[model samples]
Target chain A: MKYPQGVKRNQVNTPRADKEINYGQRGMTLEKDLDKTNQFYLDTKRAIIHKKPTPVQIVNVDYPSRKKAKITEAYFKVPSTSDYNGLYKGRYIDFEAKETRNKTRFPFINIHAHQVEHMRACHNQGGIVFIIVKFTVHDEVYLYPFEHFVKHWDAYLGNGRKSITYADIKAESILLPIKYNPRYDYLAAVDEFYFE
Target chain B: MKYPQGVKRNQVNTPRADKEINYGQRGMTLEKDLDKTNQFYLDTKRAIIHKKPTPVQIVNVDYPSRKKAKITEAYFKVPSTSDYNGLYKGRYIDFEAKETRNKTRFPFINIHAHQVEHMRACHNQGGIVFIIVKFTVHDEVYLYPFEHFVKHWDAYLGNGRKSITYADIKAESILLPIKYNPRYDYLAAVDEFYFE
Candidate 1:
């Protein structure tokens, strides 16, 4: 498994060392890592964030029993908002996380237009809105604040580049810390960049 | 259909007179009215609140083509958080909406324990948290602030009353005004009770 650069394996806490090794062996995905990180936050009472459920439009359902109502037909719906949102330290936090296998750039097509508009609205209303992009090929994750993200998005709307280059993201975004307990310590980046 | 007491039909504005008449004829539900209210808020750029999609646990899905992924088997999930949440005037707003046919009281069975805990967490974090209770028989809707709701919840936890009395709710909660454009003007109550 790929590890973030400059972090020695021995630096991890001894109690969670075995789990870290197991996580690496399993090849962690961005979604799985965020789930672990959010769970850790909840356990420690640090945040109340949660991943919103997958949006689905149910067409038919079957009631086999009093307690068992099974969805027989459904289709995924385009999400109108970010995947994760909650209150963090008295501030509203909202963000979308996406992973790309493309090594050179993060494409704009990964996010929906409605979601971008929603984030913009939230940001204007003083929410801490951001995007977490994971370049799987490089085993790196970066948090791009809404202010920076919208600049690129508006540029794209004006017939600019279709994607944000890897170099651009590396320079503009906050590189998240990887840890044993939380897996992806993105909130640490939040604390430094936003709350600070 | 039942209308809230002491309001003449002529009191509603003429611009939406036909629509309001149709809404009454069709039987307006709390969920439908809130959808209209939230949509109105969004259209006017007043707020970005949304009712979360119903949570479902998918057991099996089939891909018919590259474009269509059909969910074949799924089940409803007990929600762990409130139904609605968003940013309002820079503060996080979160609430659960419930409807009861009983005219005398609002029962605790309508809400799950996990949702209560989530609301408590948000409230403690300085978020504007509340509960919207619609008494169908009385055609009345009330917004109970988290602070007031928790008192009864704690009492129930201590083997006290299992439900909040309607008269107590009337005395403690804000009665939401039903209107033509927004349907239920709950945020007006928010503006008065919290922001004022």
Candidate 2:
């Protein structure tokens, strides 16, 4: 299985590999699926959502021509907010997506403190905030609202529980439909939960 | 005058140099001022605006330790949307900021076609979209709404006008206040125009 260039397959667990190992699914990663879904949403004029690009700090650039500038040296910078955000039904929609191979729990370590603070701030500003957790082992996806996630986050800080159990997530979150074309139809869940 | 590393001061007009030349203002660039304004907005719990980090395509990364990962090679990528966006008073706010050395007009060439398309899409989704145009030579900043900007943009395409005249901008747009703490206080315009 050939991976994309610059993708460190050994350092991070590749979603393609995880899909094949756990669910015998071939092709299409969670990230790729979500991108496709967002594109589809845009094309259909249903909603406007985008994944923010990975931040980079540039150290050097070479101007080979008047019109062309090429970066010679750079480094990736940690993102301060969620991966996805946009407008839906005149409301701000912001979310972070993550997948875990573990069947029983979604680990707290998967999310950064700044991301949590960002989510809280967005929510306070009357934006709709949520997290999409994919349990690759179970081949399931859950949309967990920021309001509920914050409670668990605060509880963890108080009690030292490092994860949210699958049971708790299933009880608290709305199940998102996985389908062709749009791939991950998470916005359907958004429509149902947020709009309704 | 030394410019920041990786920034080609010769290729494009630097805002700092423009400030020094035009207004004898020595310390702040439009970018820094907007960043401070966004931070002030966040701290005051007034809005949840953020400047999206510059995108980068990472090529190589080195993990010196189990927890430390360093990117060895990368290149900057063009962004698909506006720079700053978030929720303000339950409304989705999206915008791009640019500064020009020209005294009489704001060049249409300064903005990319993709950014115009992005602003149009956000506007279609009922989001409040605008551009912060700073005529550095005149030391004036205007908050130009996307609705009006699109008309001029379309007219440019139709009649080959390459710029929006300073007089037109002053007449059609809201002049944003330049202050000490928040710097470019554009959100005050948003509150007045969008909310009021």
The DockQ-derived docking category for candidate 1 is: medium
Cα lDDT for residue A145, candidate 2: 94
Residue A71 alpha-carbon offset, candidate 2, angstroms? 2.8
* Residue A127 miss distance in model 1 (angstroms): 0.8
Q: Against the correct fold, how does model 2 do in TM-score?
A: 0.86
| lDDT tens digits, residue span A2-110, model 2 | 8675567754666776646647352227788889999999999888899998877777877776655666666667789999999988899999998887789999987
lDDT by residue (B1-196, candidate 2, tens digit) is 6778556875476676655665645223888888888899888988888888887777777777665566666666778889989999999999999888788888988788888998999998899999999887677888999988899999998999999989988988999877898887888898777888
At residue B4, what lDDT does model 2 achieve? 85
Off by over 4 Å in 1: A1-28, B1-28
User: Residues A85-112, candidate 1, lDDT per residue (tens digit)?
Assistant: 9989999999999887788989998788
Give me the runs in candidate 2 sitting further than 4 Å from their true place: A1-28, A65-67, B1-28, B64-67
Clashes of each: 0, 0
What interface RMSD, in Å and to 1 decimal, does model 1 have?
A: 0.7
Residue B1, model 1, lDDT: 61
